[model samples]
Target: MSATGTYNKLVPEPTPHSAPYWEGLNRRKLLLQKCRGCGRIRHYPQPMCPSCHSMEVEWVEASGRGVIHSWTITHHAFHPGVREDLPYTLATVDLEEGVRMLAQLRGVPDDKLRIGLPVRVEFETVKDGLTLPYLVPGEPA
Candidate 1:
């Protein structure tokens, strides 16, 4: 990995269904899969809709606004690259679009975290021209 954790770092192995979601992040966008048949939005892109078992789906851009549904503060660095950034918050946020996403909650102290705290999406560029999305406390957009 690069000195600043900018290269050769672990990222999701994108499948064909998930490529668009990952690709969206490169442009600082959050893309979710919406099932045409059931109108359900889902993350971790899939070929078929889990709600309706339909193959018809479309990529939709998320509003990037959400509220913390749950979270945990990690005191241990599970990965070497994140050692310097330890004691970070990992959160499950319920997006305004009705999808829940799990991402690192950035710029928020452990003492400040609470359920239903509004958040917005932010991107962190990683290795191989990819970007990872994180959440930061903010007003709903």
Candidate 2:
């Protein structure tokens, strides 16, 4: 960790195709790629739409609401930088936009976590100029 309370964990390297996604998170907003050809939204931005194989795309803000599709309690940290966050929950969430996102689950207790549990996105700045999204229990907005 740095003096700014930023974690030492590895951060994402933004590419031309995914720059807007990272930029949105830095601005405390969630953004996903919307395929112009198929009118379907997708996460982890790419140059082409997977469904229609079209290069035309646009950026759209996500609602930041989703439900727990699956999760696991991590007793061990794969990276030394995240050792302090051991015993955390990593969840696979099914977003309201029909895309599945994987993020760290926080604020919700283990006993309270279950499939279909509603969650909302919360942004956390882990480093200068970088913010990541996490999930917390809440009603969809």
Candidate 3:
């Protein structure tokens, strides 16, 4: 705890540009930006697609299915908010849309964190002010 009473938690806030993405999260669904021009998918929702540099972008619903590209086992929790979640696995998953995302892994052992592990989306309230979409180990390869 800080003297200022700030928890320094991992809370996510939705901005005017990204509110829809967070809104979709509340519904337990995934949303990504797709280029209306080139049909390319984007992860960090931008005003334009990175490929064709076109401003014609639209929000497309995703399957929320992906595979673990990489992961890290957090043995120590430096922040007070994350202390309760110690030893949790943080994973970077590659979605079928070709976009990579970082999410917390659940329902799996930390020793099992491996590359190319199949994963699925799992939504939960990660903090007081936010409900985030996490990832859980999917079917075995």
Best by lDDT: 2
Show the lowest summed lDDT stretch of 10 residues, model 3.
1-10
* lDDT, candidate 2, 34-109, per-residue tens: 9999998987788988789998998888889999999999998899888988888999999999898999998998
Q: How good is model 2 by TM-score?
A: 0.92
Model 1 worst lDDT window (10 residues): 1-10
Give the number of the best model, judged by TM-score.
Answer: 2
lDDT of each: 0.85, 0.88, 0.79
* Residue-level error in angstroms, candidate 3, position 32: 0.4
Worst 10-residue stretch by lDDT in candidate 2? 1-10
For each candidate, C-alpha RMSD in Å? 2.2, 1.8, 4.1
Tens-digit lDDT track of model 1 for 1-141? 143544534568889888989899999999999999999998778799877899888999999999999998888977776786677788999999988999988888777888889999998776556788988888855
Which model, 1 or 2, shows the larger TM-score? Answer: 2
Give the CA lDDT, 0 to 100, for residue 84 in model 3: 71
TM-score of 1: 0.89
Ranking by lDDT: 2, 1, 3
What TM-score do all the candidates reach, one by one? 0.89, 0.92, 0.85
